[model samples]
Target: MTIANWCVLAACLLPTATVGLAKLASARLPSGGGRYNNKQPREWAAGLSGWQARANAAQMNGFESLPLFIAAVVLAQQAHADQARVDLLALGFIGLRLAYIGLYLANVDALRTVVWFAGVVVAIALLAMG
Candidate 1:
Protein backbone atom coordinates (compact mmCIF):
# COMPACT_ATOMS: atom_id res chain seq x y z
CA MET A 1 0.00 0.00 0.00
CA THR A 2 1.09 3.55 -0.58
CA ILE A 3 2.32 5.78 2.24
CA ALA A 4 -0.68 7.99 1.79
CA ASN A 5 -2.88 4.94 2.24
CA TRP A 6 -1.08 4.05 5.44
CA CYS A 7 -1.53 7.61 6.73
CA VAL A 8 -5.22 7.43 6.02
CA LEU A 9 -5.43 4.18 7.96
CA ALA A 10 -3.54 5.67 10.88
CA ALA A 11 -5.76 8.75 10.81
CA CYS A 12 -8.82 6.55 11.00
CA LEU A 13 -7.40 4.59 13.91
CA LEU A 14 -6.49 7.70 15.91
CA PRO A 15 -10.12 8.65 16.44
CA THR A 16 -10.98 5.19 17.65
CA ALA A 17 -8.18 5.37 20.17
CA THR A 18 -9.36 8.76 21.32
CA VAL A 19 -12.90 7.50 21.63
CA GLY A 20 -11.75 4.61 23.73
CA LEU A 21 -10.00 7.02 26.00
CA ALA A 22 -13.07 9.21 26.18
CA LYS A 23 -15.27 6.24 27.01
CA LEU A 24 -12.95 5.21 29.76
CA ALA A 25 -12.97 8.73 31.12
CA SER A 26 -16.71 9.01 30.78
CA ALA A 27 -17.16 5.75 32.61
CA ARG A 28 -15.62 7.39 35.61
CA LEU A 29 -18.34 10.05 35.50
CA PRO A 30 -21.76 9.63 37.00
CA SER A 31 -24.10 7.62 34.79
CA GLY A 32 -27.17 9.43 33.65
CA GLY A 33 -29.61 9.53 30.77
CA GLY A 34 -30.83 13.01 31.58
CA ARG A 35 -30.34 15.74 29.04
CA TYR A 36 -28.97 19.17 29.99
CA ASN A 37 -28.41 18.16 33.57
CA ASN A 38 -25.05 18.88 35.18
CA LYS A 39 -25.09 17.09 38.48
CA GLN A 40 -22.31 14.90 39.69
CA PRO A 41 -23.93 11.89 41.23
CA ARG A 42 -22.16 9.86 43.87
CA GLU A 43 -21.00 7.72 41.00
CA TRP A 44 -20.32 10.71 38.78
CA ALA A 45 -16.93 10.60 37.11
CA ALA A 46 -16.17 14.24 36.48
CA GLY A 47 -18.14 14.82 33.31
CA LEU A 48 -17.36 17.69 30.93
CA SER A 49 -14.02 18.19 32.60
CA GLY A 50 -10.95 19.38 30.77
CA TRP A 51 -9.82 15.86 30.02
CA GLN A 52 -13.08 15.10 28.24
CA ALA A 53 -12.79 18.33 26.31
CA ARG A 54 -9.30 17.38 25.25
CA ALA A 55 -10.46 14.02 24.00
CA ASN A 56 -13.21 15.80 22.13
CA ALA A 57 -10.68 18.21 20.76
CA ALA A 58 -8.59 15.32 19.51
CA GLN A 59 -11.62 13.87 17.77
CA MET A 60 -12.35 17.22 16.20
CA ASN A 61 -8.76 17.62 15.14
CA GLY A 62 -8.83 14.20 13.51
CA PHE A 63 -11.98 15.10 11.61
CA GLU A 64 -10.51 18.41 10.50
CA SER A 65 -7.28 16.80 9.28
CA LEU A 66 -8.94 13.94 7.43
CA PRO A 67 -10.07 15.91 4.40
CA LEU A 68 -6.72 17.61 4.04
CA PHE A 69 -4.97 14.28 4.28
CA ILE A 70 -7.22 12.85 1.60
CA ALA A 71 -6.68 15.85 -0.62
CA ALA A 72 -2.93 15.68 -0.16
CA VAL A 73 -2.87 11.99 -1.02
CA VAL A 74 -4.98 12.46 -4.11
CA LEU A 75 -2.93 15.43 -5.26
CA ALA A 76 0.29 13.60 -4.58
CA GLN A 77 -0.88 10.61 -6.55
CA GLN A 78 -1.95 12.79 -9.43
CA ALA A 79 1.19 14.88 -9.45
CA HIS A 80 3.50 11.92 -8.90
CA ALA A 81 5.26 13.51 -5.96
CA ASP A 82 7.93 11.72 -3.95
CA GLN A 83 6.19 8.85 -2.22
CA ALA A 84 8.79 8.65 0.54
CA ARG A 85 8.48 12.30 1.47
CA VAL A 86 4.73 12.19 1.33
CA ASP A 87 4.71 9.11 3.50
CA LEU A 88 7.13 10.67 5.95
CA LEU A 89 5.05 13.81 6.13
CA ALA A 90 1.95 11.76 6.65
CA LEU A 91 3.56 9.89 9.53
CA GLY A 92 4.82 13.13 10.98
CA PHE A 93 1.38 14.66 10.79
CA ILE A 94 -0.12 11.70 12.60
CA GLY A 95 2.52 11.81 15.28
CA LEU A 96 2.04 15.50 15.81
CA ARG A 97 -1.69 15.02 16.10
CA LEU A 98 -1.22 12.32 18.71
CA ALA A 99 1.10 14.57 20.64
CA TYR A 100 -1.38 17.37 20.37
CA ILE A 101 -4.02 15.14 21.88
CA GLY A 102 -1.77 14.22 24.74
CA LEU A 103 -0.90 17.80 25.39
CA TYR A 104 -4.53 18.78 25.33
CA LEU A 105 -5.46 16.05 27.77
CA ALA A 106 -2.76 17.28 30.08
CA ASN A 107 -4.14 20.83 29.73
CA VAL A 108 -0.96 22.06 28.16
CA ASP A 109 -2.47 24.59 25.82
CA ALA A 110 0.70 26.17 24.48
CA LEU A 111 2.34 22.88 23.59
CA ARG A 112 -0.89 21.62 22.07
CA THR A 113 -0.99 24.68 19.84
CA VAL A 114 2.53 24.02 18.71
CA VAL A 115 1.76 20.42 17.87
CA TRP A 116 -1.42 21.46 16.08
CA PHE A 117 0.54 23.91 13.98
CA ALA A 118 3.11 21.27 13.21
CA GLY A 119 0.43 18.98 11.87
CA VAL A 120 -0.96 21.81 9.78
CA VAL A 121 2.48 22.54 8.40
CA VAL A 122 2.98 18.93 7.45
CA ALA A 123 -0.32 18.90 5.58
CA ILE A 124 0.58 22.11 3.80
CA ALA A 125 3.97 20.70 2.86
CA LEU A 126 2.32 17.66 1.38
CA LEU A 127 -0.07 19.86 -0.56
CA ALA A 128 2.75 22.00 -1.83
CA MET A 129 4.71 18.96 -2.91
CA GLY A 130 1.79 17.79 -5.00
Candidate 2:
Protein backbone atom coordinates (compact mmCIF):
# COMPACT_ATOMS: atom_id res chain seq x y z
CA MET A 1 0.00 0.00 0.00
CA THR A 2 1.05 3.58 -0.60
CA ILE A 3 2.02 5.90 2.23
CA ALA A 4 -1.21 7.77 1.64
CA ASN A 5 -3.15 4.57 2.11
CA TRP A 6 -1.38 3.97 5.40
CA CYS A 7 -2.20 7.50 6.45
CA VAL A 8 -5.85 6.81 5.71
CA LEU A 9 -5.69 3.84 8.03
CA ALA A 10 -4.01 5.96 10.67
CA ALA A 11 -6.69 8.59 10.37
CA CYS A 12 -9.39 5.94 10.72
CA LEU A 13 -7.78 4.58 13.88
CA LEU A 14 -7.10 7.93 15.53
CA PRO A 15 -10.61 8.27 16.94
CA THR A 16 -10.50 4.82 18.50
CA ALA A 17 -7.15 5.60 20.08
CA THR A 18 -8.46 8.88 21.43
CA VAL A 19 -11.55 7.26 22.91
CA GLY A 20 -9.37 4.55 24.38
CA LEU A 21 -7.50 7.24 26.24
CA ALA A 22 -10.74 8.32 27.86
CA LYS A 23 -11.62 4.74 28.73
CA LEU A 24 -8.17 4.26 30.19
CA ALA A 25 -8.70 7.27 32.40
CA SER A 26 -11.93 5.78 33.68
CA ALA A 27 -10.10 2.56 34.50
CA ARG A 28 -7.91 4.55 36.86
CA LEU A 29 -10.81 5.85 38.89
CA PRO A 30 -11.46 4.51 42.36
CA SER A 31 -14.38 2.29 43.37
CA GLY A 32 -15.89 2.35 39.90
CA GLY A 33 -17.12 5.88 40.51
CA GLY A 34 -16.56 6.85 36.92
CA ARG A 35 -15.78 3.53 35.31
CA TYR A 36 -16.70 2.90 31.70
CA ASN A 37 -20.23 1.60 31.24
CA ASN A 38 -20.33 -1.02 28.52
CA LYS A 39 -24.13 -1.20 28.51
CA GLN A 40 -24.52 2.56 28.27
CA PRO A 41 -21.25 3.61 26.72
CA ARG A 42 -22.60 6.79 25.19
CA GLU A 43 -24.04 7.92 28.48
CA TRP A 44 -20.79 7.08 30.23
CA ALA A 45 -18.85 9.08 27.70
CA ALA A 46 -21.26 11.97 27.92
CA GLY A 47 -20.72 12.20 31.65
CA LEU A 48 -16.94 12.40 31.36
CA SER A 49 -15.18 15.52 32.62
CA GLY A 50 -11.78 17.16 32.65
CA TRP A 51 -9.13 15.49 30.50
CA GLN A 52 -11.27 12.45 29.90
CA ALA A 53 -14.02 14.62 28.50
CA ARG A 54 -11.52 16.38 26.31
CA ALA A 55 -10.27 13.04 25.04
CA ASN A 56 -13.79 12.01 24.08
CA ALA A 57 -14.33 15.28 22.29
CA ALA A 58 -11.10 14.81 20.43
CA GLN A 59 -12.26 11.36 19.39
CA MET A 60 -15.45 12.81 17.98
CA ASN A 61 -13.51 15.48 16.16
CA GLY A 62 -11.23 12.86 14.70
CA PHE A 63 -14.24 10.98 13.36
CA GLU A 64 -15.74 14.18 12.02
CA SER A 65 -12.53 14.93 10.11
CA LEU A 66 -12.12 11.49 8.62
CA PRO A 67 -14.64 11.71 5.77
CA LEU A 68 -12.98 14.71 4.18
CA PHE A 69 -9.52 13.35 4.62
CA ILE A 70 -10.43 9.95 3.26
CA ALA A 71 -12.21 11.43 0.28
CA ALA A 72 -9.33 13.77 -0.43
CA VAL A 73 -6.81 10.99 -0.37
CA VAL A 74 -8.91 8.71 -2.51
CA LEU A 75 -9.74 11.43 -4.96
CA ALA A 76 -6.15 12.47 -5.18
CA GLN A 77 -5.03 8.94 -5.90
CA GLN A 78 -7.80 8.23 -8.36
CA ALA A 79 -7.04 11.45 -10.22
CA HIS A 80 -3.40 10.42 -10.50
CA ALA A 81 -2.00 13.27 -8.45
CA ASP A 82 1.71 13.08 -7.65
CA GLN A 83 2.14 10.21 -5.21
CA ALA A 84 4.96 11.82 -3.22
CA ARG A 85 3.01 15.02 -2.74
CA VAL A 86 -0.13 13.17 -1.75
CA ASP A 87 1.81 11.16 0.79
CA LEU A 88 3.40 14.29 2.22
CA LEU A 89 0.06 16.01 2.58
CA ALA A 90 -1.46 12.94 4.20
CA LEU A 91 1.44 12.78 6.64
CA GLY A 92 0.96 16.45 7.44
CA PHE A 93 -2.73 15.92 8.15
CA ILE A 94 -1.93 13.08 10.51
CA GLY A 95 0.71 15.14 12.29
CA LEU A 96 -1.60 18.11 12.73
CA ARG A 97 -4.36 15.83 14.00
CA LEU A 98 -2.04 14.26 16.55
CA ALA A 99 -1.02 17.70 17.71
CA TYR A 100 -4.65 18.76 17.95
CA ILE A 101 -5.52 15.74 20.06
CA GLY A 102 -2.61 16.35 22.41
CA LEU A 103 -3.51 20.00 22.76
CA TYR A 104 -7.12 19.11 23.48
CA LEU A 105 -6.09 16.69 26.19
CA ALA A 106 -3.74 19.30 27.61
CA ASN A 107 -6.57 21.87 27.75
CA VAL A 108 -4.86 24.15 25.24
CA ASP A 109 -7.95 25.21 23.36
CA ALA A 110 -6.48 28.02 21.29
CA LEU A 111 -3.58 26.05 19.93
CA ARG A 112 -5.80 23.04 19.36
CA THR A 113 -8.12 25.09 17.20
CA VAL A 114 -5.20 26.35 15.18
CA VAL A 115 -3.89 22.86 14.64
CA TRP A 116 -7.33 21.58 13.73
CA PHE A 117 -7.63 24.28 11.09
CA ALA A 118 -4.22 23.40 9.75
CA GLY A 119 -5.24 19.76 9.38
CA VAL A 120 -8.39 20.72 7.51
CA VAL A 121 -6.38 22.95 5.22
CA VAL A 122 -4.00 20.12 4.49
CA ALA A 123 -6.87 17.82 3.60
CA ILE A 124 -8.37 20.44 1.34
CA ALA A 125 -5.03 20.90 -0.34
CA LEU A 126 -4.94 17.20 -0.99
CA LEU A 127 -8.35 17.42 -2.58
CA ALA A 128 -7.23 20.27 -4.78
CA MET A 129 -4.11 18.40 -5.75
CA GLY A 130 -6.16 15.74 -7.46
Candidate 3:
Protein backbone atom coordinates (compact mmCIF):
# COMPACT_ATOMS: atom_id res chain seq x y z
CA MET A 1 0.00 0.00 0.00
CA THR A 2 0.98 3.63 -0.46
CA ILE A 3 2.12 5.93 2.32
CA ALA A 4 -1.22 7.71 2.16
CA ASN A 5 -3.01 4.42 2.63
CA TRP A 6 -0.81 3.62 5.61
CA CYS A 7 -1.51 6.97 7.17
CA VAL A 8 -5.21 6.47 6.72
CA LEU A 9 -4.98 3.04 8.29
CA ALA A 10 -3.09 4.48 11.24
CA ALA A 11 -5.67 7.21 11.60
CA CYS A 12 -8.39 4.58 11.69
CA LEU A 13 -6.57 2.61 14.40
CA LEU A 14 -6.04 5.63 16.63
CA PRO A 15 -9.66 5.90 17.75
CA THR A 16 -9.79 2.21 18.50
CA ALA A 17 -6.70 2.57 20.66
CA THR A 18 -8.27 5.56 22.42
CA VAL A 19 -11.40 3.55 23.21
CA GLY A 20 -9.38 0.65 24.52
CA LEU A 21 -7.30 2.88 26.72
CA ALA A 22 -10.41 4.62 28.00
CA LYS A 23 -12.08 1.34 28.78
CA LEU A 24 -9.01 -0.01 30.53
CA ALA A 25 -8.88 3.10 32.62
CA SER A 26 -12.60 2.97 33.22
CA ALA A 27 -12.40 -0.57 34.44
CA ARG A 28 -10.18 0.60 37.25
CA LEU A 29 -12.59 3.23 38.45
CA PRO A 30 -14.74 2.85 41.54
CA SER A 31 -18.22 1.57 40.82
CA GLY A 32 -20.78 4.34 40.34
CA GLY A 33 -23.01 5.40 37.50
CA GLY A 34 -22.45 9.02 38.34
CA ARG A 35 -18.72 8.44 38.08
CA TYR A 36 -19.22 7.25 34.55
CA ASN A 37 -21.37 10.24 33.62
CA ASN A 38 -19.04 12.91 34.86
CA LYS A 39 -16.07 14.09 32.84
CA GLN A 40 -13.66 13.97 35.74
CA PRO A 41 -13.81 10.93 37.90
CA ARG A 42 -12.17 11.29 41.29
CA GLU A 43 -9.70 8.43 40.82
CA TRP A 44 -9.12 5.92 38.08
CA ALA A 45 -12.62 6.93 37.15
CA ALA A 46 -11.01 10.14 35.98
CA GLY A 47 -9.37 8.28 33.14
CA LEU A 48 -12.67 6.69 32.23
CA SER A 49 -15.06 9.62 32.49
CA GLY A 50 -12.57 12.29 31.56
CA TRP A 51 -11.56 10.51 28.38
CA GLN A 52 -14.94 9.06 27.44
CA ALA A 53 -16.19 11.99 25.48
CA ARG A 54 -12.89 12.38 23.72
CA ALA A 55 -12.74 8.72 22.87
CA ASN A 56 -16.29 8.82 21.56
CA ALA A 57 -15.50 11.94 19.60
CA ALA A 58 -12.42 10.31 18.12
CA GLN A 59 -14.46 7.31 17.05
CA MET A 60 -17.06 9.57 15.52
CA ASN A 61 -14.44 11.56 13.73
CA GLY A 62 -12.79 8.42 12.44
CA PHE A 63 -16.06 7.23 10.97
CA GLU A 64 -16.76 10.61 9.45
CA SER A 65 -13.27 11.07 8.04
CA LEU A 66 -12.53 7.62 6.65
CA PRO A 67 -14.63 8.01 3.52
CA LEU A 68 -12.99 11.25 2.53
CA PHE A 69 -9.54 9.81 3.16
CA ILE A 70 -10.36 6.87 0.93
CA ALA A 71 -11.89 9.11 -1.71
CA ALA A 72 -8.81 11.29 -1.79
CA VAL A 73 -6.62 8.33 -2.49
CA VAL A 74 -8.90 6.94 -5.16
CA LEU A 75 -9.31 10.30 -6.85
CA ALA A 76 -5.61 11.01 -6.72
CA GLN A 77 -4.93 7.67 -8.33
CA GLN A 78 -7.66 7.84 -10.95
CA ALA A 79 -7.66 11.57 -11.74
CA HIS A 80 -3.88 11.85 -11.79
CA ALA A 81 -3.90 14.46 -9.06
CA ASP A 82 -0.67 15.32 -7.27
CA GLN A 83 0.35 12.27 -5.26
CA ALA A 84 2.44 14.36 -2.88
CA ARG A 85 -0.47 16.65 -2.07
CA VAL A 86 -2.72 13.70 -1.40
CA ASP A 87 -0.12 12.06 0.81
CA LEU A 88 0.55 15.28 2.68
CA LEU A 89 -3.14 15.93 3.24
CA ALA A 90 -3.64 12.40 4.46
CA LEU A 91 -0.74 12.82 6.86
CA GLY A 92 -2.12 16.14 8.03
CA PHE A 93 -5.53 14.61 8.68
CA ILE A 94 -3.92 11.88 10.74
CA GLY A 95 -1.82 14.34 12.68
CA LEU A 96 -4.83 16.54 13.40
CA ARG A 97 -6.81 13.52 14.51
CA LEU A 98 -4.05 12.47 16.88
CA ALA A 99 -3.90 15.97 18.27
CA TYR A 100 -7.66 16.03 18.64
CA ILE A 101 -7.59 12.79 20.61
CA GLY A 102 -4.86 14.04 22.93
CA LEU A 103 -6.56 17.37 23.52
CA TYR A 104 -9.90 15.69 24.07
CA LEU A 105 -8.40 13.30 26.57
CA ALA A 106 -6.90 16.25 28.39
CA ASN A 107 -10.34 17.90 28.52
CA VAL A 108 -9.18 20.76 26.34
CA ASP A 109 -12.45 21.37 24.59
CA ALA A 110 -11.79 24.56 22.66
CA LEU A 111 -8.47 23.46 21.22
CA ARG A 112 -9.72 19.96 20.62
CA THR A 113 -12.69 21.28 18.73
CA VAL A 114 -10.40 23.44 16.63
CA VAL A 115 -8.19 20.49 15.81
CA TRP A 116 -11.23 18.38 15.03
CA PHE A 117 -12.51 21.03 12.66
CA ALA A 118 -9.13 21.22 11.04
CA GLY A 119 -9.27 17.52 10.27
CA VAL A 120 -12.78 17.88 8.99
CA VAL A 121 -11.71 20.72 6.76
CA VAL A 122 -8.82 18.68 5.43
CA ALA A 123 -11.12 15.82 4.62
CA ILE A 124 -13.61 18.12 2.92
CA ALA A 125 -10.86 19.74 0.91
CA LEU A 126 -9.68 16.36 -0.28
CA LEU A 127 -13.19 15.37 -1.28
CA ALA A 128 -13.71 18.66 -3.09
CA MET A 129 -10.42 18.28 -4.87
CA GLY A 130 -11.78 15.04 -6.24
Q: In model 2, which runs have C-alpha deviations exceeding 4 angstroms?
A: 30-32
lDDT of 1: 0.74
Q: Write the per-residue lDDT of candidate 1 for residues 1-130, one digit (tens) a residue.
A: 9867888898878876874676665554454632123354322323445676567567767888788877877797779898888888888888898888788788899888888888888888988988
Model 2 has an lDDT value of: 0.93
Task: Write candidate 3's Cα lDDT for 17-128 as tens digits.
Answer: 8766666655655666433434453443334444675676666667777777777667765676677887888889888988887887788889888897898888777766
Q: After superposition, how far is residue 126 of candidate 3 from its true place, in Å?
A: 2.0
**Candidate 3 residue pairs in clash (backbone atoms < 3 Å):** none
Q: State candidate 2's TM-score.
A: 0.96
Candidate 1 to native Cα RMSD, angstroms: 5.0
TM-score of each predicted structure versus truth: 0.80, 0.96, 0.74
| Candidate 2 or 1, higher TM-score | 2
Query: Considering summed lDDT, which 10 consecutive residues are worst modelled in model 2?
Result: 24-33
The lDDT of each candidate is: 0.74, 0.93, 0.72
Per-residue alpha-carbon lDDT of candidate 2 for residues 94-119, written as tens digits (9 for 90 to 100): 99999999999999998899999999
Residue pairs clashing, model 1: 28-45, 29-45, 30-44, 30-45
